[model samples]
Structure formats: C-alpha cells, structure tokens
Target: MSSSEQPVGEVQVHPQPAPPGSGPWARFVTWAGQDTIEDYSLRYAPKSFRKWSPMACAITALGGIAYLADYSIGASIAVSHGSASAVVAIIVAAVTIFLTGIPIAYYAAKYNIDMDLLTRGAGFGYFGSTLTSLIYASFCFIFFALEGSIMAQAMKLALHIPLALGYVLGSLIIIPLVLYGMTALAKFQVWTQPLWLVLFVAPIVFIATADPKGFNGFLTWAGDGGTERVTAIGVGAGAGVALSLIAQIGEQVDYLRFMPEKSETPPWRWWSAVLAAGPGWVILGAAKQICGAFLAFYVAGKVGFTAATEPIQQFLGGFGSVLHNDTVALAVATIMVLLSQVKINVTNAYSGSLSWSNFFSRVLHIHPGRVVWLGLHIAIALALMLGNMFAVLNTILGFYSNVAIAWIGAIVADLVINKPLLKLSPSYVEFKRAYLYSINPVGFVSMMVGSFFSILAFYNVFGDFMAAWSPYLALALAFFLSPVICILTKGKYYLVRPNPIREEIEKEPLWAGQTLLDIVDQKRYELPDMVHDCPFHGGTISSLTCTLTKCHDLCKTSAYIDSVTTATLRNAAEPQPTT
Candidate 1:
C-alpha cells in the first residue's frame, strides 16, 4: 500500500468477504436487507445516512403521537375517576413522562442509537436489555392493536364493515408504509401533518364555540356512579392509566436516531428538535386527554357513558355539533380517524420492528432483517384487535403501566443518576455485544424488584390504596434502587472491557473531517469520531461497516490505531488512515 493508504489499525486477521449467493431467493433476501429495511436495526446509526435536518426529524417523531387512543384514555380516566381526579392524574403523568424522556431522548439523538441500544448502555447489559426490548415491543403491538381498533370502529361506522375484517384491513394497510422504514415514514408524516392538525383541532374549536355551556357541565360531571369524587385512590388509578404511555419515548427515539450529528448542526435547531420531538410529545398528549375528557362530557348525555369513551363516538359527536348534516359529520369523523390511525400505527409498526429485531438477533442468533419482524409485529397486533383488546382497554393499560414504568424508571435512574450524578456508569453508550456482560445486576435487578412489588400492589396484594398507586410505586422503587444497586455492586458489570475509542476521543478529539479506509470494501470514507473494534479479527473498522457487514460481535474496542498510522497522522496535517 502507498503512504496515503496506510492502515490505521493493525490486526491479526482482516475481515473476510460475506459468502455470495446468486439465486432468486438470495436476490430477494438481499433486496430485503437494503438500508431501508435494515435501518441499522441491531446497531448504531452512522452519520453518513442521518442527512435529514433537525426540523424534519422532529416533525416525523411528533407524527407518531397523533393516535386517538389519547382521547379514549382521557375519557376512560375521567369517567372512572371523575374530571377533577382525571385532571390531576393527567398532569402528573405528563410531567413525569416529560422529565424521564429528556435524558433518554438526548442520549439517543447524541449517540445516534435507538431506545434499545440506549437501554443496553444506560444500565442494562447486552442481554439485560433484551427484556426491555420485549417490554417495548409489547407496548408497540398493544398500542398498534388499540389504534387499529379505533380505525376499525371508524370503518364499521362508515362502510358497515364487520370489526373482524376491519381489524385485518387496518393491520395490513400499515405494512407497506412501514416496510420502507424512515425513508417513507418521514415524507408521509410531513405530508399528512397539516391536514391531521386541522382535523384534530376542528372538533375542539367547534365544541367551544357552539356549546359554550358544555364546559360548565363538564366541570361538575360526576363519574359512573354520579357520586364519584376526587380522592387519593381515584387520582392514583387515573394516573396509572395515563402513565402507561411512558414507553412511548422508545417510539420517539426510533425516529430521533436519524438526527444529524449535533456538532454539524446548529445548537438551537438541534436542541429544539430533540426536546420538541422527545418529551414535548406529552404537551399535546395531555391536551388531547383534557379534550377527550371534555368531549366525553359533551356527548355523554346523548351517547351514554360507554359510547362516550370511544374516540370514534367522541369525534362523531364533536363533528355533529359543527356540521348539522349527520352524514357529513360521520364522513369527516371517519376520515379523521383513518388518517390519525395510519400516522400512528406506521410508527408503532416501525418501532416494534426495531425492538423485535434487537430482541431476536440476540436471543435467536439469527438475522432475518427488520422487514420480516415488521410482518410478525403486525400479525401479533392483528390477533389482539380480532381478540377485542379494546373492550378492556382500561384494565389492560392499568395492569401494563406497572411493568412499563418500572422498566423506564430503571433506565432514567441509570441515565440521570448513575451516569451523570453518581458517576458509576460509563459516560458514553456502549451497545455493541462483545463489550457487555450477559446481564448487569444494577438495572436488571432494580427493574425486576420494582416490577415485582408494583405488580403485587396492582393486584391488591397490599390494599385498595396500594392497588391504585402501583405505577408510582414502580417508578419510585426502580428510580431509587438503581443508584443503590450500582453503589453496592461498584458498577463493575457495566462493561466487560474499557472502550479505547471513547477514551481516545475524551483525551483528544478526532478532526471532524478525518477519513479512514475500510479494507473490506477497499474504499475510503469519512471516519466517525468513534469506531468499533472487530473482536474476531482484532482490526479497527468504521462503525458504518460494523452494521453494513452484519458482523454482529464487533466489540467497539477503541480508537483506530496502528503505530505507523498514529505517528503519521500526528506528524502530517492531512494524513490518510485505513482500517
């Protein structure tokens, strides 16, 4: 090799070429493994592909929150707990979601990794995060089923379709949109956002102007018994239902992972996109919940308590007030429902694919690509919809909130307390499998202990008051227990070996415009500040190749280095480095 093509790092063995296949099935699988389908599902997102502007990423992330389940959740809480308690519960949930989401979102965007990867590095080890992957995947399919049920309701109302067939159709429609991943999702979200906003706002605006007295009635409306009042139990139960959405940050970070490097982007734009798309989702969510509560009150006298809790019925009543013609109102409401469900379900499917990909890749030791998992995710969700999961929405969400909050609470404690405050964990996220222990007791034990006690509380093992307060118990226990466990264990399980690349970057940062050559591809590419070390070959490789080559066991050991290349770069201003 010439002086300009010197290898940056030495290795005992170079990366061998992937085995080739030329048959039709091989071609199809190759097509399925394209960037759009793979989407770095089991690895870090490289800077080369994260070209979208901050605002575009933010808008795409925000689009997923348009699901009408918020309306249903809000209405159910209000009807069960009364408006006064619902108000307090919704605010508490929203504030908690916003606060917990900040560190998770910031880390995902900064590191160009998804929520699963964030979890791995935050506190959970390589295998420890697999459990969280399951939890997050369950959240996706559950919400997908819930959102699809709402769409099915619209189809039943508008076209007289049976709920079973509507369930199949609703699940199938999202498949094609999600198959293309963020490439299609970004444009689809941006294009549909304006129309969705208008439809979303119209009902609230109409009710305020046309039925001004409705607000007064809503304020004093008692719940199911006509004797329900705000109480500690009522507020706890209501907040638990609302807190089920804590897992939503995973979906948001799936899109936020495509955010451009912060060093290249303007500071104001970067922070704005991260915050707005990340935790800021709850602002709109809380507003929608409040709207759901008010609209439920508006329509309850006409539609009865049960029907008032359904989004289709809620929007239909709101539209009926605005458009005097019942047919026009139903048509508009159905369109709104269809649009809302499509936007959010695509995200649910997309995020679920990522979660399942991470999960199976670790457990099964097989790589079938994300598109395959997308199909499996939709299938699971379709089954739930056909099973009428929506009928017991409150029951399911209330039970689920305990486990989900415990998982998130552990992650938050690791990010906010262990990593930053206690300084027990590593500063950077180290998700690659080779460097991590099978399980880290700090987060894993904390989550399990929290889930166990909270779930018992949810089952009324303690008392009615504890049953209502299960999610809060989960959150508090998980959050505080992580730091305590880390201190007790001395944080040794976090990484099996130190990362040299991160250490080098901390000591002296790499030049932003540096380039490195990949020996496997025999092509030069701009070097990322951090690169993964190939544990099998003991060669330094670009992080991009780590994903592209499907070399699943790379350690991300350290900075690219060979004695010659290091000295060359130190002396020459524009030295060429190879991996």
Candidate 2:
C-alpha cells in the first residue's frame, strides 16, 4: 500500500492483508502470495504487444541466414551431386523449409512466445520441452561455428588476417551487437540490408552480363559426374548437409515474434512481409543456394582442381572474373563476409542467449540477465573455432540435420494442424510451467520415434538411399506421427490448466516477466518489478533490489508461497512502517 520506489537486493513485494488491523502472519502471508513470475509463464499474446511492422521483423529474421556458408554448403553439394542434383536438392530443401516453417512462424508471431515456450505449450511439457531447448541451443552454437568460420575464411583470404586472429575476430564479433536484443538488431539489419542485397546481386549480375557462358557452364556442368549419372546416395548425402540449416527457424522466430499484429491498413504488405521474411526466407535461402552452386561451378571452372572445394575461393574468382582488379575483389569479399557474418551471428548470439536463458531459468530457476549468456555462447563458438571445426563441416552438419528436422517437424505439425482443425487442443498457445505435465507423449514420443528411426535410416540400417535422406525421414515421420499421437492421446498433453487470471488480463496477450500473478491462496496480486520471483523481506527503497525482505514470522511454514501472500509478506516482512 505504500507509495515507495522499488528497492535494491532482497526486495519484497505484494499485498497487505491488514486494514491496519490484521496480525503479522496474515499480512506477511498476503504479501508473500503476490510475488508473480514464480508461478507465471508467458501467456495472452496481444496485438498491443506487437509494435514492429512486418517489414522490420522480416529483415531481422532473414538477416541471420545470409552467411557466406551458403556458398560452401551449396558448393559441397554441387561438387558431390553435380549442378543438376544440387539444383534439385535446393528446390526440395527450399520447399521443405517453407512448409515446415509456416506453422512455427505463425504460431510464434501469433502467440508472442519463443520456441521453447511454444514447445512446452504445443504438446511437449516442462521437462519434455527442455530437450527442444537443448536442441535449439545446440543449433545456435553449431551455426555460430559454421557462420563464424565462413567469416574467418573471408578475413583470412581477403585481408590476410591470420586465421587465429580471424577466428577471434569472427567469434567475438556478434556479442557487441546482439547484447541489446531485437531493438538494436532491427536497426542494424535495416541499415545493412540494402548493401547486403547490392553486394549479393552485383557479382552475379557482372558474371552473367560479362560471361553468358557462365550460365551454360552451370547447366552442363558435369561436376565430377552429371545429374543422370548421379547415385541416389550422393544426392541424399548432399541434401542432408543442406537440411541441417533447417534449424535456422529458431532464429527466424526470434524476429518473427516481433512482427506487427495483422491489420487492414496495409494488409497486403503485412502478409507479404510475414510470408517473405518468415518462412518465405527459405525462398531467398534456396536462391542463395542456387547462386552458391552456380558460383561454385564457375570457380571450379576458373580455379581448376586445387582450391575448387572452398566457396570463398569461388566468390573471389567470381569477382576476379567480373571486375578489373583482384585486390578490389578481395577487399569487397572480405567486407561482404564481415558484414554478412556479423549480421547473422548477431542473431545467432542473440537468439542463443534467449534460448540458454529460458533453459536455465526454467530448469535451474535462475536468470542472470540476457547479456551474460551472450558472452557464454560466443565463448563456446570460439572454442569450437580453435578446434578448426570448419574442417569437418560436412560430417558434423549431416548428422545434426536429422535431429533438427525431427524437432521442427513435430512442432510444425502441432501448430498448423493440431491446434486449428480438430479442436483437440486450444488454438491459443499456452506456456506456463505451473500448468503443464513434465512430459507430453504427443510431441515427445513423436520426436523420439522420429529421431530413432531417422538415425537408424542415417546409418544404413533402413537401406542405403534411406541413409542419405535421413533428415527427411525424420521430418516426415515426426510430422505424421505427432498428430496421430495427439489424436490417440486425445490431445490431453497440451496444457496443465488455463491461466487462472485470464479475467484480469486480455485474452492472448504477451506477458513480460514483470507481469503480476494472482496468488489466490494469499488473496493479492504479486508486485511486478521485484528482481526475485520469490518474496523477500525489504532491504532498501532505492530500486527493485531493496524491495524485498524474507518472511519474519515463525508461523508461516512453506517457502513456496503464492504470489499474493508473498506480496503481503514483503510488506509485512519488513520492520513496521513508522506512522
């Protein structure tokens, strides 16, 4: 009831039960019950919360996918499967990605929850979703290494930056930019997007304009063996490498969550932005892959056998062929790589921190802040770089794609099909720990089954060609199986209970951590600004730190008090206010 500033360390919050008349325990209990975030989870996504236009979100989401590795990944596929095979693989992967991402992007934007929370509410429960979080976190680091290596190579090839220095430069580069979250990321992407587009298209334009044979070379390119001569296994193996990039959806959702709520003013633009920037990003990605494949073939034609495998070399040759000076090509290439990696890695680093924070805060019950994890994630990628991880990209990414595909497939099924048509589960997303089972058989069983079968397929246990297309196997199986499991289970695994406080808040509104929770047992709403979700005895009046004190009374037995009681106790926990 007191009008005081938030305090520092050990701050307390919540209701005062006494009408200047109640006993100490009752008042403290009322206060303790009011500490909110402890029992609350992200709920009630609303239009008011979506402040950005769709265009801003699209750029931010797609910005991270622009790594020069597109060239390397495409080249590896091209060299292995021939240009035609790589072309087929690119189209297949792009179509697959767009379809898979549609549900995820729409759900994330509509629900205003991150992927981890979505996993929990979709069908995977608290502990079950943790597996996805780990999967997602692993995706962040793996891509961080891949993208960082590409940047480092650009540095090394263009500026002659020592590989060691390039590694440090590449790895540390994202931390500074991602620290600010989506706000800073949006501006950064906006400023850089134009130049990225220009640089990306320019070399292709020049190459095509100057050497029309370049196009012919790409089409007729035997590439070790022509397309018809392709072994199914070769195509499958190459596709697996490209499919690993499917996990990039996690990063895309990080931005899509910021998409402006749908409206009539510019409905077409909004939908266009969402489609183009959301899952539509795969179209751009596939295009880049085609470009990569073409340029890789061009480079092989020009550079001969020695450096044909590397895409940066492919790019350098493209520029040398298209431009006047080799030095100019090199400098432009380095800048392009630096800009591209910096953009996407900022997203990787940013999205990773959110992923890691959600991991620890929910599982371990602690949050130091988003910035701390930024450093930790980048450090991990740095360590991977020292190990020269890029050297083994093909094998590493191929194995990783299977699990990533399975996870995505399970999630997309729940969002697109499960929640909408059958009405077996609620359409509005629910993501709170207090109301979910430790595991949901629907998503969990589906993911496990998919992963199991896909891995077996990958190892040639399901025959040779199947082994090559293991990621697709996982995707297909998980997507088909998740809903079947949901139907058989009657979709019971989705929620523990509806938000108890829905009446007080808007329906489907996005909630911040500070959003108050009603701890009905203690009869008051928790104060929203406390640093600790748990009630504290007040220590100071300066900031959130001083806003709490522990329960002072001997009568209260349980440490796990409700939000309202915690709020009451926060007031009652302190020395009585001098009248």
Candidate 3:
C-alpha cells in the first residue's frame, strides 16, 4: 500500500447505507426517476454549468413567484381586518421579506448554491439543515395545496370538472412539467411570462376604468365584522398571516443558484438582476395582494363575502363588469386562473423536490434523484388538496406563519447580524457534508425557541393578545436569539470538522474546467485539493488518493463522480501550497 493511501473504513459512515436498496419500494423508486442530473442538491453549483445570463435567470425565478395566492392572502386578510389594516399588514410583510431576501439571494447567486446548501453553511450545519428542509418542504406543499385548490376552482368553473378530479389533474400536470427540473422550468417560465402578465393585469385595468363606483367603494371598505378601524392587534394578526410567505425567498434562491457569475457580467446588470429577482419580488407581490384586496371588495359588493374570496369568482366579477357577455367573461376569468396557478404550482413542486432531496439525503443517506422527491411531494400536496385545505386557508396560514418566519428570521440574523456584527459564524458558506457538524445550535436552537414560544402564543396559552401577535413574536425571538446563541456557543458548533481544503482551492485561479475524472484518467495532473467521493469509499477523498489500486476502477465511473465533484473541479482547479 502507498504511504498516501488510507483504508476506506478510515472514513466513518453514519447510519450505514441501508444495505443497498433496502428501503421500502427502493427498486420502484430508483426506476421511476431520472438519475442523470443530480441538480447539486447537496453542494455548490459549478461555473461550467451556469449558462444563463443574470437577467434571464432572474426573470425565470421571478416567474415562479408570480402566483395568484397574493390575491387570496390579501383578500382573506382584508375580509377579516378591513382594507386599511390589511394594507398596513401587507406593507409590513413586504418590507420585511424584501429586506431579508437580499442577503440570502446574493449568497446563493455568488456561491452557486441553493437555499438548503446556503442554510447549511450559514449556520444550520449539514444534517441540522435537514430540519429546515422539512420546514421549507412544508412551505412548498402548503403553497402547492393552496395553488392547486385555486386551479381546481378554475377547472370547475370552465370545464365543469369536479373539484376532486380537478385536484388530481392539477397536481398531476405539474409532475411532467417539473420532471425535467430547472431546464424545463426556466423555459416554461420564460415563454409564459408575457401571457401571464397580460392575463393578470388586463382584468384589473378593465375593472378600474369601467366600474368607477365599485373602484371607489373598494378603497374605504371595512370588514364584514365591522372592523373599520386599523388597530395594532388587527395589523399584527394580518401581518402574521401574510408573513407565511417570508420563506418564498427559498424558492427564489433555488433558481438564482443558476445565475451567471457577477465577474463576467456588468455591475449594473448583475445587481439589477439580483435585486429584481430576489427581494424585489416582494414589491410586485405586495402590489398583487393590495390588488387582490381591491378585487375582493368589488366582488363582495356583487356576490356577497363568502364567494368573493375565491379568485375565480372575484376575477369573474371584474371581467363581467366590462365584458357584459357572461360566457366570454367566464372564459377570460378561467384562463387567467388556470395560467396563474399552473405557473406557480410548477415552481412549488420543483422547490419542494429540492427541499425533500436535501432532507431525505441527510436523514436516510439515500439519493434517488430529485424527480422521485418531486413525485412524493406532489402526492402529499394532492392529499392536502383532497382534504380541501383551501377552505381553512386562514387557519392554516395563521399557524404556519410563525414557523416560517422563525426559519427565515434565523437565517437572516445569521447573514445580516451574526456573521458581520458578531463575527460568530464563518464568512464563507461551507456545505459539503464532510466539513459540517450534524447540527448547529445557533440556528436550530433559535428556531426551536422561537417556534416553541410562538406556537404556544398561537394556541392562546398566553391569552388573546399574545395569540394575535404570535408570528411577530416568532420573528423577534428567532432574529434576536440567533445572535445571542452564537455569542454563547462562540459559534463552536458551526463546523464539526476543520474547513475543507477545497475552500482554499476555490480561491485559486487554475481550478476551473477540471474534474476528478480528469485526474483519475491521467488527463490532468493530480492536486491535493481536488476532492471527490470515492465509490469504493463513502466519504469525499482527494484525487491524490486516486492512485490506490482498490479505488482506481471506481474513479472511472462518472456516475460515482458525485454532484459536488464537478463543482470542485470547475471552481477550485488550481491549487497553491499553504504558507
């Protein structure tokens, strides 16, 4: 044996490998999804694969967030709290989301990593991020169920399809669309952008111009409960409900990971693309919510409050106002609903698949590819749809907003507060499994403390006022506690092992356009920093060890090259000796 060679068992394997296809229905699962593209579920994205310009990538990401749920959220709040209070809550939520999203999006784009990977590096640690994945996965499916329900409503009105069948069709339609992952999603979002904008905006404009009286009335509308005054309680409650969307930034960064490097692009263009596609999404989203409120008020006057909450019914009233022809109005309303829901649900399924991939990979040590998770995600959402999740939308969002806000707030605190102010966490985002702790208390403890107390408040354990302020309490606790925990723990738990050598290699100029296979095949010179997961060995090992006879044949198989290897090859190819 060579002096540099180490036995495979030297690298510890946690939880074992499930005895090679031992999970329930493992064979069927492996057969169902494409394994060719790993989607960088567990690591950084390499430069060679980042083909899109910043502008194109930003727009594609923004397309996924362009859902009609804003309208639904806005309408639901307005219906309960009145227009003035709902408007206040919408503004607060928008500003909060926009501000926090900036740092997260920038990191994801700059590092070529997704939200899960970003979270791991930011503070959650490797397996610690698994909990967050479940949180984010829940966000995806919750929204998926909401968006799917909206589509089902559209189908019922247009094609006279039953809600149950429509639910199945809506959930199933996204499966094929999302099956191809970001490649198909980017094109789908781009081509549909123009049509979606037209359908989305045209009716609102028509309503404003044609129905002057209704438009005027919408501005001063009060809640059905006769809450005309905008109290702090009402605003807090409304904001909490709307704040359930704070984690949508995760979905935005999912696509932003594919953004072209800023070094190659003009400064103005890069910043503009990042801002517009990142936190800037909330600007338009906030406007949509306010617009939803207006439409809800207008529809309420015509068809009563209960029916007014339905986007299909609300838009139908708007179209009917101008079109006069009932059949034509129904057609336009249905088309708008279908287009909007389809666009957003595809994003939901895609993001969910990524979250689930991050989760299952860490917990189960199984990677069946993202498509299988996509199916599993849609299946869960379909069940939620069948249960009629939309009917209790307010209850669902009100409770969910706390956990979502806690997750986002903890990340935001780490990025904006803990990293810079306290210097408690590392500056660079380190996501590779071999380098991170299984859990990090800074984020996990803060999130737990925040969620636990807030959920208590939500259930009225502390009484009515605290119940109404639960989401805010969650946000405040998580944001404030993150830095506190970091200080106390001295950020010791952030890394279970020393930083990987790839961190230094990534900074080297000669690292690009190289792969582990190149070294193993003797196509390129071996460097100490060129690391890859050896097929014969479970852990990431440097190409310097590629000469070992036991691992020589395994390195030839490209599938065993792993997702992180290409990234390491492309970004950190050139290595320099340590001082």
Whose lDDT is greatest here? 1
**Which number leads on TM-score?**
1
List, residue by residue over 1-579, the lDDT tens digit for candidate 2: 332333211123332234465665454445333322111112223333445777778877777777777777777788767877788777777788888887777777755567887888787876788888888888898888878888777777777788789889877666667655666778888889989998888778888788877777575566755464555676678789888888887788777766655433277876677677768877788888888878878878677633565656766767766676888888877777788888888878877877876676555544445555666888888889879888787788888899989988888888877878767766666564544567998888888899999999988898988998999899989999988998998987775444434322334233322233222222222222212232333221111122112223211223434544676778988898678
- Model 2 / residue 117 / CA error / Å: 1.2
On residues 1-579, what C-alpha lDDT tens digit does candidate 1 reach at each position? 543564342111112223577764454366444666677777667666776999999999999999999999999989988888888889999999999999999999988889988998888898899999999999999999999999999999899999999999999999889888889999999999999999999998998888766678575577685334577888899999999999999999999998987777899999999999999999999999999988898888899999899898999999888798999999999999999999999999999999998887777665556777888899999999988998899999999999999999999999988988888899878876656777998999889999999999999999999999999999999999999999998899998766665655445434323455555544444433234456554556554344344454534324433443475667897756888
Tell me which of candidates 2 and 3 scores higher on TM-score: 3
Residue 212 of model 2, lDDT score: 73
Model 2 residue 373 lDDT?
A: 62
- Each candidate's TM vs. the true structure? 0.89, 0.80, 0.85
Model 3 RMSD in angstroms? 7.9
When summed lDDT is taken over every stretch of 10 residues in candidate 1, the lowest stretch is 9-18
Q: Give the poorly placed runs of model 3, Cα more than 4 Å off.
A: 1-37, 505-514, 517-579
- lDDT by residue (320-415, candidate 3, tens digit) is 889999899999999889888989998898899989877876665555567678889999999999998898998999999999888888898999
lDDT of 1: 0.84
Global fold similarity of model 1 (TM-score): 0.89
Candidate 1 residues lying further than 4 Å off, grouped into runs, are 1-28, 226-228, 507-535, 541-579
User: In model 2, which regions exceed 4 Å deviation?
Assistant: 1-50, 224-231, 263-267, 302-306, 500-579
